[model samples]
Structures are given as C-alpha cells and as structure tokens.
Target: MPEPPDPADPHQPIPHSAPWWRHAVIYQVYPRSFADADGDGIGDLPGVTSRLPYLADLGVDAVWLSPFYVSPMADAGYDVADYRDVDPLFGTLADADELIARAHELGIRVLVDLVPNHTSDEHAWFREALAAGPGSRERARYVFRDGSGPDGSEPPNNWKSVFGGLAWTRVQEADGSPGQWYLHLFDDKQPDLDWRNPEVVEEFHDVLRFWLDRGVDGFRVDVAHSLVKAEGLPDWTVRTGMLGDQGEDGTEDAGEPATTDPRTKELGPMWDQEEVHEIYRGWRRVLEEYNPSGDPDQDRILCAEAWLPSQERTMRYVRPDEMHQAFNFQFLEMSWRAEDVREVVDTSLRAADEVGAPTTWVLSNHDVVRHASRLGLPVGSPRPNGIGAGSEQPNPVLGLRRARAATTLMMALPGSAYVYNGEELGLPDHTALPDRLRQDPAFHRTAGVELGRDGCRVPLPWVADEPSYGFGPGPRSWLPQPLLYGPLAADRQEGVSSSTLELYRTLLRLRREHDLGVGGLHWEGGWGPDVLAFRNAREDGRPVTVVANLGEDLLDLPEGLEVLVASGRLEDGRLPQDTTVWLA
Candidate 1:
C-alpha cells in the first residue's frame, strides 16, 4: 500500500520504482467529443494535443483516450478499420505521436483504447476474408461458420446481438449464392475475431508492439471478457441471453441482483469465458517485454473493460499474470445508498485483495448517462439508455449535489480512480437531445426502444460564449450541444471556489499531498445507517476522515475536527443531506 512519488507535482521526475498506476488518477478522453482544433465539425488528434495542458493542470496521472484508429465511424470508432494507423477523421500518425509526446512532457501518461474482440467490417483482414470466400485462411481469422436449418436460412444458434437482431450476419458467396454467416456480438459492422486462429493471435501482438513502440503508456482493453466463447458455442439457457434488459449505459446488464451472489448464476456462453484469461496472459508478456527493468513509470499496464457476473469473477482478469486492473462496474451500477456503496466497496476490496490488484473505481464513461444525471433518478426507477426530448428528465440541482458528493467519497478511498471528461464541470447528460440527431448504434438497432448512449457522448463545452461552446472554432459540432452547457462550461468555473471544476482541482491536489490514494482505510463507528464514515491513514500522522451523508436529515460534525473541504456548503456548520465532507 506504499504510495508512489507525488505525481501531483509535474516538476518531479517519475522514478523507476513503484508502479504509478497502483493508485493513479486516470482521466478518460472520448476523442470525438473532447476538442476540435479544426473547423471540420469533428474532434481530431490535434484537438486532443491542444488540450494536454488542461489535463496536466487537472492533476491526473494519466489520460485514457478512446479509439481514434482508422475507421468508417460505424459504432463511433469502435469498429477499428486499421489498428496501426490513425483515422483521417482524427488526424495523421504524426499527430498521434505528437499527442503522446506532449502528454508525457506534461507529466501525464497516455493510454489508448484497444478493441481486440472484434474489428471493423472495413478492416483489411475482414475485407480479405470476405473476398477469400468460405474456407480460406483469411476467413479462418474470424468466426465464420455455416448456418443450420434447411438451406442455412436460419442462424446457427439463437445468440442475439448486443445491439439488436441475431448475432450472426449472412454473407453472399463470390458467385452470388447464399453463403456462410459471420459472428458479431456487437454491430454487424464489427465482426468478431477468432482468437483460436494463430494468425489472429499473432496479428494483435504486432498491434500491441506498434503502439508500445510509439510510446503509449498502456491500453484500456475494450470488451475484454468476450474475446473467447464457450468451447462449442452453446445456446444460452438464461431468460436474458445477450440482449438482456438494457443497462444504464445502453449495454447488456448481465450482472445478477446485488443481494445475491452472481457466482451462483450460471456463466453465460458469450461472456466471462474461461479461455479469456489465456489471451490476457499472453498480453501481459507483451507488456512486460517493454518494461524489462520493472520500473513502475516504464510499466505498460492493461485495464480490462470486463462486465462479468461478480467481483469474484472479475478478479480473475487481474490475476498476477493477467490484466493490471478491471473496471469496478459493481460500484458504478450501485444506487446512491449507504448500504449499497459500503457493500460494493467492501466486496471489491476483498476480491481485489485476494489477487493483489488495485480496485479501479469509475462513476461514468462515454457509454452511460453521466453520474450527475443518473444519481438524480428516483430509486428503483428503470435505467434508460439515453434521455430524449420526451424522456423523463433528472433534477439537475439534486443530481449535481449528489454527483459532487459521490466523487468526493470516491476519491478519498483506497486504490485508483477514473474521471470521465466533463465530470469535473458537473455536466449533466443532454437529456433533451432530439431523435433526429441521435447516432448511437444502440438507438437505431433497437428501433428507438432504447434511446442509446448519444446523450453522454455530446461534445464538451469549453468556452461559455463561443460558438459550439468552444468545443470547436466552427459554429456547429457533430452532435448538437445544449444551451445549458454554456452555464457549466470550463470558463465559467475556472476560479469559482464553489464550482465543481475547482472542487475537483482541490481534491486532486490534496489527494496527492495527503497520500490518500495509497493510504489504508479504517472504517469509523457511530455513523448512522445512511452515513458512510471512514478514516484514510496517511503516511503522516494527520489522517483524513471522509463522511458522506445520504440520509434526508442533516448531520452534525464532531467537535475538534477541522473541515478541510466539502461537496456542498454546510448548513449552519452541519452536513446537509446528500453531501460529503473531508475533516481532519
């Protein structure tokens, strides 16, 4: 639990010792919406390079950029057309190199998104597979199988796509006759790769070297749990196969109820397969090759974006020879309740402790409604994929209060944390986005039953008064920005003490100064059922106590304790409902 050298100070050189990511603050940058240097109505690599200073100033140890690989924009760049090249939509390879270099100069590590489970239909390999016909070696690189049921009209199995429709898509033979079908767990534009193929395995290893050679600190492995399937690709017997009830993120919620142990449930054929561990073990070797000295700063880490049935199942991904971290989705999915929060925190720590890995905490990302808005939804309400003009809206006032409080509590805990861009601005989801402007595949695939993740992917607002709220120099952005963004733009909160942006800056600064990230947690007694109180034991004798009040009633702070920072203003020296405070 020893803390690494203070990354909070950019002037200090990162030593070759202690793995920095163990307790680092990693910021997620959704490239298409982060910033736009060009007036082409889309964000590019140059746009991201121009914003490095902002991230440096935010005090994060690293920035995890979502996919900017060459793509046709189907699935919003998740369908990678080329693993080694930057998309024209983003910029040239030089721009990516410059972005990575500049980020390192500013004392921030850079992580790129890697989607290994599948590739775009336009990828060179997939295209060759299509042209090479049914039994070619190129076709063997992907999951190509003959369909069943007389004349092969029906899919081989009942597997459903996460987006919508059947998981298998039929293709016409070179002679214009009906041919074999291909498997795609997500959109049809993204075809799943057959990891069993030696070529497929070797190809990704080369891709890893390409980026590692280019100076990327690590990779955030997307859909890491689904790379390998059941040995025979059996049909799922559960009520909810692949297209389970939509999660808040517009993806499948395969997790069982929190009250029950998800391990008790039978593992789905399409997810958390046993074979996925072997793939990551090989990846670990690739990462280790770059860090021969085992220097923490030089270590290339892998964080799995796995949505497994339980923390215990998820822990397998971060075993000693596997990934370095896995997203703490249980905490992200939990409602705003003391019991729920405590249970997730306790169980997550216990599970990760067993494997000697750090627990990664995340509240929001590009796929889900921002926590600011989701926290406002009434308890027990159905989680919508996106909030449209006619959808039920969240209370902005209440949402921001809880969001700030939740963030404060999250930062004060042990282990690492991930901050999605725009969360610092206290931005809520664009709930009123018009249907005509929606573009997430989840929206169109489900025939609009699910609003999709477009609300959260809206471009960020940088300047309060400029065109497109300063997201770009142009008058318009790819996705329309709501007028409300103007008030919450970065400029408006720059130095405002009460603003969420300033609050985040202070928290990050103090988190490093107090050595809270690597510190140990000691639960404090006497707190009520609706309150969570714990002491973070710092290296110094001065320990920091974090108290979050989720109850409706105000809580009185104990005498002799100094209030350092608070999520919201205290009412008459008492903690207000849905507020969090740090005291010494």
Candidate 2:
C-alpha cells in the first residue's frame, strides 16, 4: 500500500495507506442487475465475486452494492427485514464472505448500502413492536400514535411518503384487533424507526459494527438526512394531492404548500441535528476503533445519499465529525448547458470549502433518467403544424461524446467520483418497460404520473448475443435487457479499440496514474455560455485544466494549456463539437 497524499495538497494525490476507497473511484453495482450466478434470473454475491476481475480492469478502486440485505422485495431491497443477513434471493452469508475475500484479493473495496431510516413491516423488530401493546418499550422503537382527530378523520400530520401517499399506516395488534398507526417514509410495509429511541440507535450501531467486523470496507448510507424527524409533529399547512388533510387549526389546511413539503425547509434546521452528529460521531469512532493499525484517529470512508438541492445543506453531511462525502446531486440535475455544469461545479467547490470537507460528483444514478436518453438528439417526421413528432433515434456519436465528456469532467473534479453501473458503456435509458412490467414502487403507486426508475435499473449486458444478453443464461431476467445492449456487452467490447468501455478504462487509468483522483478543484473563469472550465491542483504541485463543450459548436482553449485528454480531437487549441479536454 502507498502512503496517503498530504491532506493539505491532495492533487499530488497518493493512494490511501490502508484502503483505496479514501480517494477511490467507486463503481455502483445494482446486485440484482449486475450478474446472475445461479441461473436463477437474478444477480447474487457469487455473481459479483465472479465479476471482480472485470471491475478491477475498469480501474475502479471500490464497488458499492445497493441494498442486498434480507427483504420482502416490497421496495426492492430498501425495505430491509434483517440488516445482518443477505437476502436468500441474492445469496447466502457464505457467499457475501466469499465476495469480500475475492474483491479484496482483486484490490477492490466493497461498500454495502445501510438503510437505517426504515425497516420492513415483516422484520422481527417491527413485528415485535406490533405484538407489544401501545406505550410498551418495544412499541417505542417506531413512531406509534392514536388515531386521527376528534372527528375520526385523517393522520397526525400531512406528511406524504416518497412513494406517493400518507406516511402513516395502521398495524394490527398482537390481540388480532385494529391497532394504532405507525410512520413509514416510503411504502406501507416499510415503517420508519424512531431514532430518538436510544435502543434503536444502539442496535443500529451494532448492525454497522457487524459489517465492519465482517471486513466490509464502508457504507453508502441511504436517506442519511431522514434519520431524524421534527419532534413536534406539527400538521403540514401546505396541502397538495393526497397529503393535504384537515388539521386542528379549525380549517382543514394547516401545513405549508406541497412544493414546500418536498424541500422540507421547516425541517432543515433539524435535518442534521446535534443528535444526528452524535450518532455519526459514534459510528465514526467505532470505525476508527476497529482500524487495523489499532489507532482511533485514523480515517475511514462513509458516503451519504443526500438529495437536498442546497449545497450548504448538503455539505453538513460531510465533515470530520460527519460523513466523509455526500452525493452532490447538482450534476445529476444539470442540463446540457455548459453554463449549468460550470455553476454546479463552482457552487459545489464553495460548499465543500465552507464545511471544511471534500466534494463528490455523480452524473447518473438509479433514480435519474439516463444521460444518453436525456441528451440524445430527438428525431421524427414533421407534424401537420410542421413540428416534428416526439420520436427520435439517439445520435450514437453524440451519445458517446457526452459520455466521455462527462467521465472526464467527473474524474478531474476533486474528491471521489462515482460511476454508475452500465454508465461506462453509454447505456441509454430503456423506454420499453410496459406499465405491467414496471417494478418501481414510485411508478407503480403513482400509476406512471411519476417517472419510473426502471429505465436506469435495467439488467447489465455481459455477453452479447447470449440469452437475456448474458444478464442470465436463461430467457428471463429481473428486468428486460434492450436488444441494443446485446451488441454492447462487456465481452464484445473487451480489447476492442475505440469502444466506450475502452474510453472509460483509459480515463480511469489516467486518473490513477496522474493522482487526479484526489485534489482541490478551482474554477478560474466565469461560466462560458457553452463551456465548463476548471483546474485541479494537487499538493504535489501538479495542476490539470479541464474544459468541456456542453454546446454543439466548437470551443477555443485558453493559451498555454496542453491537451492531455479530450472527448473529441483538439485542433490548434480549440475543442471540436461536443468535446471535452484535459490540459496540463
């Protein structure tokens, strides 16, 4: 192992002395869609182990597995029934151990998703809470309250679940009769835990320690911001859709409007509360205590999934006393405009500086529309009014260009960069999933009024031309693979020149060799109308400038910069259309 680069000057970035994840390029693997090992039409731990070499070859230092814990598959694996064991649908305990060992042998760290916000109603804990009478100790582990107002109507508040309804549900008591209501932030089967309960906090801490003891590298905490809720239980004044209910204020409406609810401005001050920091500090302390060097101050890795739009708010989740990094969602929300990208980068850097923490970048994730689909040129016959129909074939060249440009921009950014599975291959979002085939709870519950996440969660194509495109050896797959992906499998692109996979490999290799993976990024100019430009300087004094053309036209480079990487060819210091360039 190499010594870590100086904390002051990360650009001279050296690999971390212990695990690579401190500055690693993490690749997210949606296990159920990664690779199926048992011919069971679903991916498992053994399948992940078998693909370790493939990930290693892609130059990623770590892989983050989305929730593989035991669940009833209600909210896909987010509704965890047992935090310590693997879902039988995915694999067994032995398989997970084998995966850890194999990933380590290949020099890849493994991070599992830790969803502490809620648990499946079927979980023993939830079941126990149901069995315990109201006001019992066990029942306090979750939010439990009496029925609605004196009029016998509505919930305690107007909070709506992310999956599209009231956040509360009625649970049957152990006596086989109607019981009190419980809180759920998503599906009715997944009830939110009361973090205020010391026992719940201590028990979850134990769960965290269990995986660390098992040699897992770190965690991608799901809904880290939602760990705690406002204690007052005030009725939401804003009413929108079904979340609006009559309140005690005399009138039926008492909460802020619906738009304000998603932002949860009222909850911001309490979002990352002192108690939350204490909880994170405790978890960090545990990780440090278990450090192989036996030192308690050593650094470990913990990434958080914070979907807030405010950069200042997002930074709160990443500090010495909090998480190591929180996902910067600005890039995911950015348009194709270069100005938009530049503003996002600059804002993110400022945010990180304010919190004395590092920043992270992500282009796409399970929740967003695929970049290719979002950027592809639209095509169709002209309508009667001379406007073209909404049907269009993707511009393959432009798609590849956007993919490469995004990759270069992400790699050149400071802190860690996460690459979603299938992103490197320029996988476009699938539009063929019918309403009957859609499995996303959000889409199913909203009846397609809300966009489904199924497009991005489709199965990966491993072997071109194979049944289900090698996602499985059989005809069935958890999610259907597009025919287009059949010609873009890993085996098909392996060793092929000019393939999208090759571009990813080359970019990642450059990132590793130049220590570009860790550094301090600074923007040197105002937002260009169609270009994003910035410089990354390591403590070692190596500075690289990155310029991306978000427009369809050519772009001229600043003087004295030599191109080191480009999404398209550079001609006399000017970028070609739809191109990205790295300069030294």
Candidate 3:
C-alpha cells in the first residue's frame, strides 16, 4: 500500500463545476461527546472548533453535527427548545459561529441537525400551545386530539412511542379538568408538530433561513421520513410490534417478520407518508434560495435520516427537487455476509441511479451500536439493544476484524459516505454501561428491555492517558468511558501505518485520488459465494478492484493485481478470512 500523505498538507479544493456532495465523505460529530473545551464534561461547539484541523487532516469533505440546540436534553438535543441558538450545554451561539468559520477555512463544510418533527415541551411554541387551551390557534400548531373512552380518559389511538409507552400525553386544562391530548412519537417531552398546519410550516421555513443566513453548508434532517402523518392519524394494528420500535444497529424489528410483498402491508400511519415529499420539496427550494446564482458548488444540501423499509422508498427523498441524500440504512443493517452486502449494494446503486442521485453509505451512527462491536456478534444473532455484563459479549478481536473489512468495502462503493465520530479508531460500544448511568430514552421507556443507544454515545477518547481521555479538562465525561478505550485512543494510533486511524486516512485519500465515489461498479464473476469481488471504474477508465473474504478459508488473488491496501494483514500473499483488499 502507498504511504498516506502528510497530515499537515492543505486539501485540494473541489472544482466548481461538480457538486461536492455527490461523492463526498462526510463525518458525523455527536457534539455532546466529541470534545469539551470547558470543564463541563459535556462536549460543546468550542471543543469542535479546536478539533477542526484534525478533521481536515483526516480527509473528510464535511462534518455533520448532531443537535446542539437549546433543549431540555430529554432525548439529548433532539428535543429542540430553541431552533436559533446553541444550547448553554454546548456553548453560546458565538461559539457555533466560530466553529463554522474555522471549518470552512479548513475546506470542510458544516451540516447541523434539523429536528423539525418535534420540539421540546418547554419550547415557547409548545408552552404557548398549552396556555392557549383547546380549540385555539396556538394549539393548532401541534397535533392535539380528543381522547377515546368514557369522559375522554383514554389515549385517542393505539399508537406507541418509539421510546415505548403511549404516543399520546394528556395535558391539564386551566380549569383543572382533563384537556385534549397531544401526540409525541418518541418521548412525551417531545410534542409532534402538525405539518398540516400552515403556521407550523412557515415557522420551520424561517428556521431554515435562520441557520443558512449564518452560513451553514447544509442540514441533516432528523426523522426526515416523519414530519407528515396520515390525514386521520389512523391506528395501525396490523403489525405485532410498536410502530417505531426500530431495532438496534439500524435493523427493523417490528416484533414480527415484515412481509416481502409490499401489497401485504401498509406503512405505519406515522412513517414514510407520501406527503413528506412535498415538505422536502419546499425545503429544497429554501436551500436553493441560498445559491441564487444556481452554482452547484454553493448548493446547500439536505440529508435525510429516514429509516424507510426499502432503498426504492428511500430514493424518493433525494429526487432532483428534494433532498440531496438520504442515509442507506439498509446497508447499515446488513449482516457481515458476502451475499447480503452485495445484494444491498446492488439495490442501493440501482435506486440512486433511478433518481439521478448519489447513494449515501453509512456503517454506523449515533443511533446504533458501533460497527466494531456489532459486526463481531455471532452470525444470525438478534440485533441487541445494548450489551451488558450479563449479555452475551461480542468477540472483540473477531468483531474489530470484520468491522475493518466491512468499512473498507463500504468506502470502496460508489457514493457519499458518513464516518461516525469514533469508528476511525476502531471504537466499540461501552458494552457494559451500568443501568443507573444509562440516559437514552429507549432504555427507560422500555423498562430496560431495550438498552438504548447510550453505550455507543459514550464520550470519545482522544489522549490515552489524560483525564476523560483528554475529551475535557474535567476528570470525567457526561457518559462513562470504558477503561478498555485507552489503547484505541487517537493519540495512540496517529502515525502508526497499520493502525485503524491510518487505514481510514489512506482510504479517504485514495477514494478522492481515484474518484471511486463517482465510479461505476461491475461485479466480477467466478468468485465463491463467500467472497465478494467487484471492479470500480470512472469515466477516466482507470480501474480499482475490491475483494472481501467472508469464509473461514483463505482466498488466493489472481496474478498481476497490484494490492493497494488490505483491512487485515494478508497471509503468505493470500487474503485471510474476514479480510478485504483493494487492488489496481
């Protein structure tokens, strides 16, 4: 493999004619755990600014931050109390502005989380809706409905929260009587907005302009598949599980096996409604307004975090007049099997081609178990919510091996890619987080049946020996970091050629140099079912081949293929089990 370029060099700017997002590598920073500049033990915007140079050197085109908006932190920052300001927990608005400026100066674009689906119950709008009583204009801004049962004592529908429990929460009327109930798809503290209401639509449009005016490059729309519900908010009893009880590792676990025939089942009333496209169409217009000259380079992108059932449905959000990209959650949820991986890749590329959009590939995110730990589980094991001391533990060595190989395969694919905050260091979930310290709403709402995402959101380790691994000056982090993280810290891996960090740097650099993200994929025939082999070529016609061995036996490479990089060390010039190789 060629040695990676020095970390000190500046990035070559993208050409103005091409939209950088089409094949960009974007990094996700869950700000609350990225770095804490202050002694607060929680990450903030200033902390992100201090790390901008590191990201630029790592070769990502952009950084997408999880929410840092003013919030009650009920679901971390997803429950937004204020759309226009940074939360005090994440530093002031000035800190955000500085972070944006520093990122742009480093040639890295910035994308912030936009939670338009719901707001913190404490948000001024929500509070006003409560104060205005039932049947008032302010109440119309949210989804409020009368309850069923005697004296309106029962929830209006059979809907359940993704976090668990009833989706409806009744409010206390001013006269001390039971009032109309409001809808909350995730947590009671987060009230779902009524997209059918013009007032709600106008408010979000202004919110988009507010951040765009501050120079944000794009938005990662949270619950982007949501925001619009069925006209009557119908009850869905066809499924055996909770409506939004998406499983761990981005897999769909609706209690029963979903039918392969689309005609046999309908989308739940709260998810993937057709009307959501019109909302994004309007958002696309808002984004275009920022690039009045129609320059593709200046285009503000919107990436959807929608977890739809199929890639074909996912493609709808990225049509020419809608979002630029939606996450390929299907790829993320795949088991570490050659056939599964190849199948999803084929479907994903075809869907993107149909829409004239670049597919977006992601291995892990804040919402799922880190791939380093997830990929190691035994084949066909259930997608676990969280791994505790009593749970069957993943084989650390085996898991990391497959993780490296899986990520190598993902990077070699054709599309934009997202690097979750710490996957570059081969980070694993803090699998044994104690129940008392757990904060994810999924854990509490499910009464521990679902361990939730806190294990994956544990603060990142920077310096191996420093306090909180140098995440902050404080002696601790907001969420506990496992002691095992020391060896995998960034400082320990920086210049080591064989380290995971160095491997990522090499992959990102080669991806750009080869234009692989915009390349076409052609599957190679005559490979075993346990092996995946494909060649990638762009318009320039120079080809790069990627091969992964998922079987127990070693696989031989045909002669004359110049090996560029390998996920694991090759054995006697042969690819070993759970290894991936890039060749030219």
> Which candidate has the top score in lDDT?
3
The clash tally of candidate 2 reads: 11
Candidate 2: tens digits of C-alpha lDDT, residues 1-584: 98753332323233234234445788999898898988888888888888889999999988899999999999889999999999999999999999999998998888889998889989999888887789999889998887777743457676666666677887667788766888776788889888889999899889988998888888999878777777766655432222222222212233332223443443433244456666777777777767769542334568888666468877877777778888887666565666667677767776776676666778777766566665554322111100011334456667667767777778877667899999888887775566667787766665554545777788899888788888777878887777888878888888876677887898888777767756656565654577677677766766888888776666777778676767666767678766778888
Decoy 1 TM-score against native: 0.94
Instruction: State the lDDT of candidate 3 residue by residue for 282-362, as single tens digits.
Output: 989998999999887898999998877789988999999999999998888787888888888878887787788888999
Q: Against the true structure, what is each candidate's TM-score?
A: 0.94, 0.87, 0.94
Worst 10 residues of 2 by lDDT: 380-389
Q: What is the C-alpha lDDT of each candidate?
A: 0.85, 0.73, 0.86
The lDDT ranking, best first, is 3, 1, 2
Query: Between prediction 2 and prediction 3, which has the larger lDDT?
Result: 3
The regions of model 2 sitting more than 4 angstroms off are 1-22, 151-153, 237-274, 292-299, 377-400, 522-528, 556-563, 569-574
Error of 1 at 262 (Å): 10
Candidate 1 local Cα displacement, residue 312, angstroms = 0.7
lDDT of 1 by residue, 202-227 (tens): 89999999999999999999988887
lDDT for model 1 comes to 0.85
Higher-lDDT candidate of 1 and 2: 1
Indicate whether candidate 1 or candidate 2 has the larger TM-score: 1
Steric overlap count per candidate: 0, 11, 0
